[model samples]
Target: MNNYYILGLDIGSVNISAAIAKFSPDSDNLSISGIGRARTNGLKKGVVTNIEKASTSIRQAAKEAMKTAGCKPDRVVVSIAGAYTGSVKSQGIVSVPSGEISINEIKRAMQMAQDNAIIDKDQVILHVLPYEFKVDGQDHIEDPIGMSGSRLEVFTHVITAEGNSIRNLIKATNMAGLKIDNMVLAGYASALATLTKDEKELGVGLIDLGGATCDIVVHLGNSIVYNDTLPVGSTNITMDLSRALNTPLANAEEIKINYTKLLESGVSELQLPTMGEVSLTHEASMDIVTKVIYARIEETILLLLNKFENSGYLNKLGSGLVLTGGMSKLDDIRNLTSLMFDNIPVRIAKPRSVDGLFEVSEDAKNSCVVGLCLYGSGEFTRYEIDSNGELKYKDSHLKSMTSTKSVNSAPVIEKEKVEYKEDKSEDLIKISKISEKNAEDMHTFTKILNRLKQLF
Candidate 1:
């Protein structure tokens, strides 16, 4: 067996997370090189704004990861999430003339549905999750690949993204000098690293709380059935603190991370930063802490849970809530999850059984990026590609493989004639527009400074 090294990167509005790991054929273990995180620039609310800034940060991140993993970059799978990603379940049915049907016919019928997929001009398909397949009039047939059937029906989950979202991401990665070998959704990455076989089988709700956005994914009966994202998270809490206490964003972040607790830590007022660990005491203004955070986190959870409930298939909370990400690290968040989710178990999901996790026991906090690397290294080998530009799968993307939901993996669209020819006309126009924008920004900055001087 050949040894393969994998790099996973999760890019967010506030931070860039990178991890490097190599797999050996001799063992089922992974050697984690290092994990790198840095404040993000050039992106806003999960979308790339300035390619130069994003690329610079990304380049630095890659270099840092390389140093940690002790290996130069070879391949990387980038993780993405944002507003433009939409998920839907579509089904196709066809009658087979013979009493028995081969896997080829069922698969071909599903392909016909995918062919008619609503791929718009500004969007690209990211995933094709198969929910269930039926034979003849039978329902919930797991795999029809070899089963005999007169009629084949497949239920699938199709995920699509805004073309510009991916285009800008690819552009930034290219500029940063990383090969865009694969693109995986941030939710999928987190699930891969956190959710277990039983959880996916019974149903699991994985919520990733990041700086600027919150990604929610529910895996029921072992495959992803529902996914929804909201444009708010830890950063909003930071902003609230900043505006409330008249402090810089950096200072507010410090307060939230070090002082804030899920429930009242029996204290209200806590120091911004006291050298190291925050000592929780009765004298601490527990009210103040909860007052600041409860509403913010409460509202966030309510909105997200409500969205999941509305989905019908996700409200049951079968596997409970597994919260991850930087924001999920807030002390006692598990308590809040219980109050908000009710009856369903809520626990912090950590990345166990992966290499280099000893430095941080809370691997779930960075689960998405790390999981991306693990899954990128053949963990999501549910996809198959043959000669010609055709992509085939054993089942739809949402079907569970083991006891858990077996996501078909990110869909592969056959490479087409990429018109990479330089758009000289558009390039020239873009340059002029960029120059004009820069000049306008400088003028605005100067105006603000002048106004401040006048006030002083």
Candidate 2:
């Protein structure tokens, strides 16, 4: 009967999405409890512009999720994306005094690698993911612990962001009456929810196209090698359409969303509801819309491709590309991307293996938030929210946990035992089925208990 809840909030330029999941002590699985979303304001290109407006959006989204889950969450794992987000790789080597690598030696090597990294004074490290360990010049050693080697070396990919940007996000979330549990790069989170084990192992690229930003992460050897965020995204296309067609922003958005289908239909003309029933011909409207959309999307994709090429990992990607987020849902985008990438394999990614409210679990736009929940299920640092809505670190180092002590009577469980293995597809399939069944059976009880717990 012991259950724990975890909340993941994705604050983006276009919208704020929140997802709540219940973790059970007896099972290493996450059951979706509720999901909520609200239109976002006060932000542009994933950076907070107005704290009060951003806080209001976050509060509204969280409140809707809390009402659906029937419990209030004091803390949340949040997703961050912007042009300032980036990653760099560094290597560290240390001599093992004992001639055998121990955990301490590994930690020291990682520390050395982190110290060797060159970062700006205003930047803060978000994640230091070790790609591999080498023992005595031997490469590809997954773990060096207990290995007899005079020297231990570690290669790590470190993610960093502008410190002020992070502070702004923290300030907005705090004002929303929620404490930050952990912050994950939006690209990393989306990859967690969409990219499969095979794709990651064989080398792949994930592109999360949001409203105002395009987040890119490259994975190889089952680890992140490079990540960056571009300032341009789907909103640019909408703006282009708005300007080229001389239409309102709302109407332009509608056209952009349906542009592909409209083009495919080969209609000569269309009537506009916004223009007082004025009829627009394809030669005038569709061509302009197509040209605007194509130009912007092409520019964005080329820029991303150039970044990948510059990273020197472009040739290493065997799985090609997996696209997710709101823009990926656009009709014909897959073909468009494929053509741009010279027919490299491209597929639109949807959230899978997530047992939750149907809409959120299946939506590409919710990938980051859902992935935040999945990321929070693993080992992470803990933060505390004071009564006055301030965030404080509970510890300096990352902590591992199997359950969370709720702020009230509700117990929260963490799915620490659940591990995703590349060769264990059958196991994952079985687990997915079991989770789905559990979700179905617990549907009623979850609603009732959540409502009851709200009274406390």
Q: Please give the lDDT score at residue 342 for candidate 1.
A: 69
Q: Which regions in candidate 1 have their CA more than 4 angstroms from the true location?
A: 94-107, 260-286, 381-417, 421-456
How many Å off is the CA of 326 in candidate 1?
A: 1.3
Q: Write model 2 residue lDDT over 344-394, tens digit each, in one string.
A: 899898876666576776778888988888765652212221111122222
Cα TM-score of candidate 1: 0.79
- Candidate 1 lowest-lDDT run of ten: 428-437
lDDT of 2: 0.71
TM-score of 2: 0.79
Q: Per-residue error at 135 for model 1, in Å?
A: 2.3
TM-score of each model, paired residue for residue: 0.79, 0.79
Candidate 2 clashes: the total is 4
